[model samples]
Each structure stands twice: as C-alpha cells, then as structure tokens.
Target: MNQHLRRLAFACTLFYTAAFASASQEKAKAPDAPAATRSRTLVIEPFMRVTNSSPTVVELQIALRKFTAPGGKGPAVWLSAVSHIGETNYYGALQKHLDAQALVLFEGVQARASTNAPAPEAARGAPTKEPAATQPAAPAKAAAPPDKSAKQTSIQHTLAESLGLVFQLEAIDYKRATFRNSDLSIQELQKIMEGDPDDPADASPAKKNEQLDRLVKVMDGSSFVGKMFAGVIQIIGTSPRLQGLTRLALIETLGQIRGDITQMNGLPPDMQTLMKVLIVERNRAVMKDLKSELEKAEPAKSISIFYGAGHMEDFERRLRRELKLEPGETLWLPAFSVDLQKAGLSKFETEMIRGMVKKQMEVILP
Candidate 1:
C-alpha cells in the first residue's frame, strides 16, 4: 500500500477508537475534550466538490461514524444519500454501520418559481392593467394550462401522507416553493414522461435508471421546481425556521424515497450530483441557517439524515466548518434499534453495531 493509504488507515483507527469509546461509554469513557475549546460544528461532505477520486468507501464510512459519534455532547451529525447511490459507496457500507439512524427521506421536486420573487403584483399595491376593450369579439375560452406546482404538491402531499404507514421519517425531494405554486397536474406530468425514451437492455444502469426515473415523474422538466427547491434548501440552510420537526420532515421525506425510487426516468449523470445538491447540500445549507434558528428551535438532542451517498463529502465538510464539528460529536442514532435487537442480537449486539461503525471510521478516514 502507498504511504497515503497507510496514513489514512492510521487516522481512521484513531477516530474509530475515539468514536466507539464515546458511543459505548460502558466500555470506557472517551476522553472529554474541553467544552470551550469547541464551537458546535456541523459535519458535511465534498461529494459535490471531489470527483474522479475514489476515496475508500470503507474509510468514509469510518469517518461518518466518528463524526456522528452518538452519546457525545459535542457536535451533532447528519448523513444522507448514505444508502441511495453507488453500490458499496456510502449506503453499501451501511450494513456495518447500523447505528446510523435516518430521521427523514426526500420525496420529490417542488419549488417556488423564483428565489427573489417579489410579492404578487396585486399584493404590492400595483394597479392591475386590464386588457383594452378592443374591437375583436370574444372567442370561446380554451382549456386552462395545467398548474405544475399544484401537481407536484399533490404528489408530495400524497407521499408524505402515506409515509407514516411504513417509515419513521418522511422521505422526499419536493420543495416548499413548488408547493406554494398553484399550477401543476398529474396528466401534464404523464404527458411529459411519455415523450422521454425507451430503454434498451445494453444501456448502462445509470442510463436505465434515469429513464425509469423520468417515467415516474409524470411531468417534463420544471425549471421552476428546480430553482425553487434550491432556494428553499438555501433558505432552510441559513434561515432561523429550522426546528427538529421541520428537519424531521425533511429527513423522513428523503428516507421514504430510498425504497420507492425507481429508475423509470433516469436523469443525466450530472444530475446525480445535482440531486446531491438538492438533498444533501441543502441539508448543509439548512444547518448553516440553523445556527440562527438554533436559538429558537431548541435543536434536537441529535438528528440523523439519509440521502444520496454522493453528497456526503460536500455536506460533511460544510457541517465541520459551519457547525464547528468535532470528531465523535454527532451520533447516528438508529431509529430501528429495537428492530436490530430483535434481529437476534442482544444488548451486546447493539454494542457490536457501535463497534462496527467505529471500525468503518477506523478503516476509512485515517
């Protein structure tokens, strides 16, 4: 192995030791870092920034556990796309790090038309300019163009409404701005999907998946949806409105999509990165905004987010810098801990999950 790999391995080891010890303090109390020495930090990843480089998946998982070290009072940890993207990359490693508990999953795309949209022209006291009573006789009214936003809202609402039936969180990709819009429809979306393409067997998985994904969208591209979601994520990242419930809603939305996400309409490969921006990066943006929100919302004892694994790098870095992340600070609490307990492992098994997570950190982030 090269020197770089060796160093990484060593770093992973130290972090894993620290994290595992902290989460399972029953073994031995991890040394407490001085309180004032730290400012609360958020952990994010460079999944967006780093490309063409294959960071060890195992190593990254190790790092995740360390950063998300549960039972630590330092910084909080949030992870997403952890199990959704490339095989064995993030979510693939999840088999080992069962300690990671995701609170929400993304649903679908929805956004306000613009980030800086002014209040409705009417609301601003702007006088309405009525059309002139010109010479032409009135023709029969045509059918109304579909309301794109409303279409998306119905889908999102339906999905959210259905989520509690199965998962603990509401998984989704929809944005609030999109929900605010009144124009959208299931028929319009189906028409959009109908024109996309047919999949050939030889096509790559990504391509096939993109095609399949679009089949599910029922609508064509909505730039309004895209930009709106980006804006809301930006708003959530920096705004003071972030409360645990809101964050929970977001996490649950994303998580619910994990299983339901079908590759009917595959997006461009670049969109893989974009989705990360939508899901994970937005989480960072929301948390960055959360600093201000924390004063009011009373941030959770902890929160776990699961989205595209690709966004892990970008979001984790953002969390560290913005949230003042400390190692082993954020613990990935498992929502299904009891489920794991019943899976044949005793309390000792739970400790094993903690150790497994620690091992991944030890393996990856050195």
Candidate 2:
C-alpha cells in the first residue's frame, strides 16, 4: 500500500505538472557588483524549471519571453508562460506587466454556446474606422449550463490551497478590455477528442473518452487513488515537515522532467493525444488569433500571449516560422519556493527525500 501510494503521488504530480505546464517576481535590488564578478545566471529554457538557489532553498520558476518581427518594425510579442497556481505576488506582478500591453491573447476554453464569436471587424484582424463611442456594446449572453465533467474537484485549486498559494483564475483579472480569448470552445475540444466517425484512422472516441474520464477522476479527487492522493496532500498541508519533504520531492521530480513536452512521449496513447490537443491544437488557435491581430491596419503596438508554460515552445516555433519573429529578452518569475530548514527539515532528511524522489523518477521516466 505504501509503495502504491508513492507511485500514485508521482503519477499525479507528473500529470498535473505536464497538464498545467499545460496551465512571479520578487523585486530584488540588484547587488552593486561588477559585471565580471557577478555569478552567471542559468540560460533560460523554453518554459518552466526548478532551481536551487541555496543548499536548503529550491524554487519553481516560469518564463516570460519577448519576440519581435525582423528589423523591429512590427508590434513586439511577449510569450508569458504561467502556472495554474502560484504565489499571490507573482500573479500581481504578472498582472502589472500585462496591463502595460495594448492587447493580451489569453487561454481559456469555454462552452461552445458561451463563447462569443469574434466580431466581423475583429475577424478580419483590422480595427474598424468607426469611432469607439459610436459602436454599440454587445448584449450579455446567458451563461451556458455547467459542464458535468468539470464538476469534479479542481486539482489546481486544491493544490494551491494545500501549498498556501493562489489559483491563477482567482488571482489574475481576465475581464480587462485588452484581454481576448484565443482558445477552442470546450465542446470543440471534446469533438476533436471524440475523433471523426468516418475516419478509421482516428482512435475510437469511446475508448479515448473513457481513458480521459479515468484520468480526470484521478486528478479531481473522485477516484480511490485520488482520495488517497488528496489525503496525502492534506497531510502535507498540515505538517511543515511534510510540506518541506514534499517540496523537495517535487523539486527533484520537476528537475528531472524539466517541463519538456517531449517527455510526455512515455505516456499512454490516449494521454498523449489529450496533451497534443491541449497544447498543440489550442496553440494553432492562438496563432490564428495572433496572425489576425498582426494583419490589422493599426495593430496594437505590443501584444502578449498568456498561456500555460507547456504551450510556449510550440508558440515560439509558430512565432518564428509564421510571423518571422526573432526571440528577444527573457524573464524568469518565481512561482513557488521553499526553505527546507524553515519548513522543519534537516539536511539529512532533505537529502534522503531527494534520493527517494530520484529513484521514483528513474522508474517512472525510464
């Protein structure tokens, strides 16, 4: 049972990490050190990472990168990779940064009926010549019925509470005028996953949905394993020692995985397909919106794409290939960090937990 629980924890951790990667900044004064004397910072990877700043302190950081068209003639684009859950101030800082942009293309899948079809003017990716004051406001549509599949407990919210952090939706204000939805409707995603009826090459929708449902149950704390996982999360939440140990374990596990989307090749076919849809197909939607915006007669001077870290790599590629954009500056935001000593873990205990996590990763990843 103990071994089973351990495996379950690892599985749950990996899934959420990937899914959310498929979903912060401390203002620190720079030291007055000479450039040559300063320690070299680690090269930024594609999206998320786990870094150890000290022997006892570890952090999980997400990336925000800038890209621009050739000769810097067009509007600059920013790819802000975010976690589904993070420190309060991190989101606050992120919000401040995004508020500076003329437009923000964000990710949020809604029901088909609830999704607002882009206006004909916006569809053409051009600003209407009519004055803003002359344009009538859109009527508020009735809310779509709640999705049954989404009734399950939110794993991201639960994990946020357990870790004393905040969920992204609760922390970031998405209602701003600058924000625009650039994701598929939930029904559209489901249809794609369901596969085409006439194409035998497509995987069976029933089989795929069944597999997806099982995974959702596990993630949302509905299944037996999920209950056990929630119990573990609760225990970790209540005990500082457990929190510290769990943080260490997570750091080790995430360190090995490194938020590389390719690492998901080891997962089951259904899961791989799910991720492909979640990251790739949705990315196509975002790029479509991006191209539309760029085609506008007077496009926003600056635009930002706020999406799960897992999707950034594909977005980067699209920006480079389709838009002919060049990568520019990058910023690392600390999402979650923990001090082993402060959390009541000794040096030996930290090392021990890390060793255990490494062994589990060996089995899981191998």
Candidate 3:
C-alpha cells in the first residue's frame, strides 16, 4: 500500500509539470498586444507635402475615417502643416475648431517597447536560485520588420522617403554647436551665415540670407526681442538644453515664418513682435497647447491629431498617462500601397524604389 501511494504521488507531479509547460509554450506564441485599446480618440490628419501633385494625404485620411467609422468613433480632424505654416495675423483660424484630449505629435521613433526591461532586476523579484537542468532551447529573438513587397505605398510614405533624405542631411550638418553668450549678436549671426561657418553646411536647414531679411520685415514694429528670437530659431532650432528634436518641427516652424514674413513687409515693430512671440517661442506654448488638449475630455465628436512624432510622448506618456491606453486602441494606420501599373515609373525609377525597399519586405526571422 505504501509503495502504491508513492507511485501515485510521483505520477501526479509529472502531470502537473506537463500542464504548466504546455501553457507557457502557448503564451510564447501569442502576439504582442497593442498599447492602446479602443479608447475614444480624435486624430487630426495633416499632409505636409505641397498641393496639386498628389492628394495622397487627403485620400488616406478619408480612407482612415471610413475604416474607423464602423467601429463607431468620431469624425477625423483636418489640418495641414503646409497650409497652416503662416499666420499673417493673430493665431485664430483653426483655434475655433480645436478641442480634444491632446494633439499628440509623432517623431516617428518608437522602437523601444519595454520600459521595464531597463529597471533593476532585484526590484522585480528576479530568480536567483539554481534550478534543475532542462533541455536547452534557442533564445527567442525580435520579430522581423514587415516584409519588402509590403513596402509602405502611401503618399505619407513617399513624403517620408523624400523627407528622410532631407532629415539625414540636416542632422549631419546642424547638430548642436556651442555658442557663447557673447556670440548672440546680429553681426555674429550674419557672419556665421556669410562665413559659411559650418563646413559643408550645405545640409543646414536655413534658407538663403534673403529669407532672414524677410523675417525681419515681418516683425517690423515688434520688440527687438522678437527679432532676436526669430533670428535665433533660424540659426539654431532650439536651445541646446532641449536637444534631440526631430528637425521637421523646426523646419515647419521656420517655414511658416519664412513664408509669412514676406507678407509682413513694412509692418510696425509691435506687429512683428507678435509674430516673434507666436512663431519662435516653442516649448511653453507647445506644452500649454498639449496640456489643454489632454485635459479636454474626448467628446462624441473627437478625432486624432498627427503632429511631430516627438509630441506623442508628451501626450501618451506625460499627459494621458493615467488613461493607459491599451495597445489595440491606439491605431497605427497601415501605410497604403501603390499599384505598380498605376505608378507610371520609368524602369530605372521602379528599380531604384525596389532596391530602396528590398529591406522593407524581407523579414529576418531568428
């Protein structure tokens, strides 16, 4: 009887162990769930490219709106960086239409998915004991990037490609340089531009010297501070303390001023001062704008706003941190594809695109 009891206990232990191992295997195969579930959201769609060539942005926005509607969400918002670049007067046009939880921007750099991975293991109660030996298995690896034939085909993608080339050039050239407080004078700035102080500054995002003149004219009657700020932004996008920004944000801001300044020719100093405070003052205004939106609860009519991907952190992690949006709810619209037949590319152009995306579709499974 004693021998039989011992046999029964051993068999039960084996059965339990097998069950636990099977469950663990199943968990490993499941997909990584999304970061945001179906939390109500309003997305403001913006297309940064110029007009008349291709309406890819508007088309994609419409497609996304249609796709999300069946899920019973609100209308998507509309605003374009190209169109809103200049505010000839006070910032008013879109103000009336703006209201939401937050205008989350994207810098397009969210590769790290684990914040906890870097935390202290002891704090997480990591195991320290030597356990029984088991059959060795290969270590799991990262999922392969989406496949190449599956290259992003949307207009945003084409813009992203063209803009990526531009961003890389700017980074190589204008990475932050130290400037002494004594060097913050108009004469020095002019010299920097004239001297071509940065070797191979061909990649600098600044426009021609004429562009700076136009900005000065726009702030004609404004305070000297305004003129200084505008000049500073042109020379350096942000203070060194706030470095590591996507150049797109600064380029877009400067683009608006460069475009609007031409209209401000002969304006009084005060008018120019207003533009100064409006255009060049980045951090505070942005934080305030973001805070206001995040505080505003999602109404029945809310949508998503796509700004610089950098702004996404302030919205997702900083502002709406409490909401803890589940992964499935935060929708990343799949970039659209172009029909090869309709693209009308020369054989060379087609080959170039294919080569660029050869890595796009190839999934390197480990």
Candidate 4:
C-alpha cells in the first residue's frame, strides 16, 4: 500500500504539472489572416523555465515577452505568460507591470448560464461572432467570472494553499478598466468540446463528455488520483520539509517539458482533443480581439495579453504569422523557489528526489 501511494503521488505530480503547464482558457473564432504554415522550427523563446541556483535550490520562472510590427511601427504588444499560482510578490510585481499598459487582453472563461435559456449577447457584453472588418471596436465586457466551471472547486486555489503560494485570480486584480475579456464563453467551449453534430469527423458527444468528466474530476479533486494527490498535498502542507521536496519535484518536471509541444503526445486521445479546444480554439478568440483593438483609430500604445504560460507558444505563432509582429525584449520573473537546505534536505536525498522525478517523467512523456 505504501509503495502504491508513492507511485500514485509521483504520477499525480507529473500529470498535474503537465496539465497546468499546458492549460489556459480560450474561444472558437477563426483568424483574420491565413493560417501560418506549420514548421519544424520554433519562432519564439521559451516562456517558462526552471533554473537551479545550486544543488540545494531551484526556481520556476515565467517570461513577459514583447513584440512589435515591422520597424516597431505599431503598438508594443506584450505576452505575459503566467503561472496560475505563485509567490505573492511575483503576482504583485506582475500586476504593477501590467497596470501601466493601456489595454490588457486577459484570459478567463465566462460562467455558464444556470438554465437552458440563451444568455443575451449584451449581458455577456462581448462580440459573440467574429468582429466585422469595418467594425472599429469590439464591445467591452466585464472581467470573466472567477472560476471556469461552477461545479468544480478552484483547483488552482487549493494547490496554491498547499504549496504556500497565492492563486493568480486572487493575487492579480482583473477588475481594472484596462483589462478585457478575451477568452471563450463556457457555453462556446462546451459546444466545441461536444463536437459539431453536422461534422461527422468530430467525436461522439457521449465520448467527449466521458473524457470531459474524467478531466473535471481530476481537476476538481474528485477522482481517485485527485483524492490521493490532495491527501498527499495536505500531508505535505503540514511539514515544511515535504512541501519543499514536492516543490522541487514539480520544478524539475515542469522544466523538462517547458515549451515542448510534443508533451501532449502522452495524453489520451479524448483529453488531447479537449486540450485543443482549451488552447488552440481559445487562442483564436484572443487574435480576434487583438485585431479589433489594432483596428481602432487610437489603439493603446502598449497592450498586454495576460494569460497562462501554456498559451504563450500558440500566441507567439499567431502574433508572428497573422499579425506580422516581431519578438523583442524578454523579462523573466520568478514564480516559485525552494531552498532544499532550509527544508532539511541533504545532497543525497535531493539527488534521490531528482532521480525519481526524472524516471517518472520519462515514463509519462514520449
């Protein structure tokens, strides 16, 4: 039983790390420009990374990358990749930096209507369809609701507390006037995941729902794995030493897969499809809003897309191919750090933990 729990804990750690690393919210609008041709090359620098200051300390960092049009003619756009949870000071620094921007296109899925009745377009307060070419501006909407799914507990929040960190939603202020909702509505996200009835190529609704339920259970801490993982986290939370070790394992795992798109290859088919909707489809919505903003007579001089680090790669592609933007300066911010020495770990134990995490990641990632 003890060995079983240990294996379960390691699996859960890797799964959640990958899920969070690749996770963010989005919508289904098509891009204004032709799709960028796929290439084997990477166009932008990695937006997330893990670094070892010494054998006894490690750090997880996120990047805020800036981009601009040819000769830096247009607005300076910043893609601020963020972790869903991090140190309080990390969020504070990020919030201050973003507050200087004239417009902030942020990511957060809106709430589902409680009933079957369609939510009014105006109540939702954003363009339901793609913005017309002649339209100068898209309708402004309030920041999206705090949680994506009404039924699920805020997994990010729970994880933050367990790790002695702060949740992004709580730490960053989204209520500012400069911030705009640039993600898929929960209804739209569900429609995409449910598969189009007219398109026979899409998966069956029942199958999609089954996969979605499994995902929700894992995220909401209701699945056997989630329950066991949460129990492990709770135990870790009680001890500074355990929390430090868990943080180290997460850093190592995340660093190994940072900005590697192939990491999705390990996911089940159904879950992969869901990730597509979450990352790719929603990215379209962001580009849609960005286009509208750029079309404005007086667009913001500096605009920022505040989203999860997982969304940065796709966003970089869209900005380059669709908008003809060029990458510029990159600012790295530390999100989480652990001091193994302070946590009572020695060189032998630290190396042992690193070895175990590496072995597990090898099994999970192709």
Residue clash pairs of candidate 4 = 26-184, 26-282, 27-282
lDDT of candidate 4 over 247-320, digit per residue (tens): 77777776665344434456755565666556656676678788888998998899998888867877887787
Q: Please list the residue runs of candidate 2 whose C-alpha ends up more than 4 Å from where it truly belongs after superposition.
A: 1-12, 18-44, 110-152, 196-202, 213-228, 258-266, 356-366
Tens-digit lDDT track for model 1 on 277-336? 223323433343334333444543434433333334444554444454554433332221
Residue 174: error of model 2 in Å? 1.2
lDDT per prediction?
Answer: 0.30, 0.63, 0.25, 0.68
Q: State, as a TM-score between 0 and 1, how close model 1 is to the true structure.
A: 0.27
Candidate 3, residues 271-345, lDDT tens digits: the string is: 333223322222223334333444556632433332322223223322223333322232222112222234332
Ranking according to TM-score, highest score first:
4, 2, 1, 3
For model 1, the local distance difference test gives 0.30
TM-score to true structure, per model: 0.27, 0.76, 0.23, 0.82
Which residue pairs collide, candidate 2? 20-23, 21-310
**RMSD per model, one decimal:** 19.9, 9.1, 29.5, 5.2
**Residue 17 CA error for candidate 1 (Å)?**
34
Residues 194-251, candidate 2, lDDT per residue (tens digit)? 7634324556887666665665566567888767766666554665555555556665
- Distance from true position, residue 137, model 3, in Å? 72
Off by over 4 Å in 4: 1-9, 25-40, 53-55, 110-141, 145-152, 196-202, 222-228, 259-263
Q: Pick the winner on TM-score between candidates 2 and 4.
A: 4
